[model samples]
Target: MTANSPLANPADPADRGHLLTEQANPRSAQLDRLSALELVDLFNQEDQLTLAAIAGARQGLAAAIDTATEALRQGGRLFYVGAGTSGRLGVLDAAECPPTFCTPPDLVQGIIAGGAGALVKSSEGLEDVAEDGAAAIADRNVQAHDVVVGITAGGTTPYVQGAIAAANRRGATTVFMACVPADQVPTEAAIDIRLLVGPELLAGSTRLKAGTATKMALNILSTGTMVQLGKVYGNRMVDVAVTNTKLRDRALRILCDLTDLDRQAASDLLDRSNQQVKLALIMHLGHLNAEAARDRLAQHQGKLRQALEARVSG
Candidate 1:
């Protein structure tokens, strides 16, 4: 209803600057008339900003990871809510957690404004509905222990704002990620992460730089948080779920790398442990049986490195 309110002009495309994927070229005069090689160089130069934006948000990201981890430790969930590219990125991150860290699907969840159908198709209309966003959180039964992250390029999506508001009301920790400056970031969310990669290559097209920044941040959040939670061991995805041929191959490689075991031995360990890479690693490294390996893992709180070290020391 007010000028600063997210619901005021939900339909206005310009007001959703953070959601806009296209950014105008500052060197429009030179870039618009450049040759192929020149254009390539220009685009490459523009992409350099994405990493810098991520670097600047390191502190905020670290805080978010800590908050999310604390919430998960207490039997809570992590929820990602957004629209369009932001929503898709959130879903992408959530989908990867199970295979990468062997986490439960419900541990990290993503909610798009327009639902599953909107993942592939653009459902711009849903972005304007405050109630739709609020309902998504309510239906999930978000509680005080949960951590909800709202993603929006422009920092002004009604759906994202509404979701953060609802999550906060329910006593859940709320984090907001956007491309705008901190001063321009919406005040509804508790933690504001502004990955300001500047404007897009095409005017108002946020999927360019903004999307890239969001993807990078999400990668750090999920991977870093998992590592902190002991899902990883010394740069290895120890808890990786071998659900496919590629993953099975990767698991074999991980065993070989960690224990210097022959292919046959690693394969035997993998089979003996039912394709659990961490358990296989522990069994071989710790020279323990499946049950003993599992018990050691539990003793170390699933930290393979610490468990292996204790075994070696003992």
Candidate 2:
């Protein structure tokens, strides 16, 4: 880079090194010249690196899940912070948690560099203002019980780095999700999840491979935390909000699977329990009224299996 380059700060780790994401991919040197089928084949081969990267980071990912689970169990919140494609992906994952596990929207929140408006428009410059990220963490009232995940594919987003630092100062559990190696952009967050998907198919366009891997990791983090929080029973999401016709069908299917009941019976049971799949199942299996089942569920801390085991043991 020239001396006039905006990213020419000698003190910044980001400005000093060769960014893996921005490096030209030798495999895709003739990308533009390739036929449609050739490009597709090349892209597919490159995408295979995403899963391998995740697999290599399995131990770290599992640690993140466990940390998130403990925090949420203690009535803490999870926040996803980032910018550009990384920020948008974080918002997408956070937005899906509620309806999927019946979690409150506040339970899982997303904060983009430029707020909600940046989700659509390109607020790329906002990520350069590192203080904004620190202020965002403070604005959310993050505490020791909270978990803040900073997503930055290039691993050099000043906004994400600042947020992680602020979150650390607040004594909150912080996880850093980055696509670059630790040596490229080192972080001090309690958990570091490196999704090294190599160089993207389009060189620096991390929205392709890095974005996919980040999305998958966020999915595992949220879904796995929910499962540990008793939002799931077996493979079924018992805490799912039956707000739509499709969800209603899923609720019925869950009930039918857990109990030897017909569709009509499950539907009736669901209605009697106010469409609460967990409550309905408990009501039917324990031979208790809706209120009694509700109390039992609460007593067992929303664990369906534990409640059933208690009933059998009692």
Candidate 3:
């Protein structure tokens, strides 16, 4: 369906310009005759629009993060539901959360339209079936405390809408991230994030501007949410899970950077803390053992910065 189509409207004043999504780009024709360098420059120029779109939706994004953080703190999960490129981006973000923030695998999840196989292939047809989306949420056993985010560039994907509807019915906090304006969003979402990235360079192909904006919004949502939840200490990713050689090196670097400790000392602390980067930092910086660090962390509700400050004052 085209952007101007009547089915896309949801009676929201903040979304009037959304119906002109197809007309948002004036340089589409120029791309056909552009040289390689010109195309690269054009892409870079369009990329700037993505950041502007996110800035416009910062308040909504912050609200979504706050709601999601509270749910997560109460032992709830965060689910990303989408299709096509949006789905793949969600999967990518969810996959990184575990290693970057030390979250459990089940704590953050991605549910694409056609399941795991859809990640590597096109599942465009699956997006048309709202029932499939609802079924996916049900199968995941989504609970009331969970937060479900529906991502769609056009804001009218039946699959994502249906998933958000189901999640809402289950008492989950439903958030919608769309490149189009808010009016294009269905009634299923509790918080609507309208990231107006204008139009695509290739006519209706949202993978251009729309996809880039969606990725940026997701990055902010996930990363900012993690930071607010105390997974970070100051500006450092203290909760990083050092699972592999590269991450192990990064953990040691973080420890050394934060504590001014030598590499050997950081490595020793990490080993003692079972490769938990946050605990290691606390143990070294606060001059505490593993158990003491754990207690301090718990006392401050897992906030590394607060725990460290408390240690200093004590």
Top model number, lDDT? 2
Kindly report the root-mean-square deviation of model 1 from the true structure over all alpha carbons.
2.4
Q: Which residue runs does candidate 3 get wrong by more than 4 Å?
A: 1-21
**TM-score, predicted candidate 3 vs. hidden true structure:** 0.92
Q: For model 1, what is the alpha-carbon lDDT of residue 172? A: 92
User: Of models 2 and 3, which has the larger lDDT?
Assistant: 2
The total number of steric clashes, by the backbone 3 Å criterion, in model 1 comes to 14
What lDDT does model 3 reach?
0.84
How does each model score on TM-score?
A: 0.93, 0.94, 0.92
Which residue segments of model 1 deviate by more than 4 Å?
Answer: 1-23, 29-31
The model with the greater lDDT, 1 or 3, is: 1
**Candidate 1's residue-wise lDDT over 10-99, tens digit each?**
647654444424445575446567889987887788889999999999999999999988888788999999999999999999999999
The residue-by-residue lDDT of candidate 2 on 148-250, one tens digit each, is 9999998778788778888988999999999888987777889999999888778789899899899899888989999988999999999889999999999
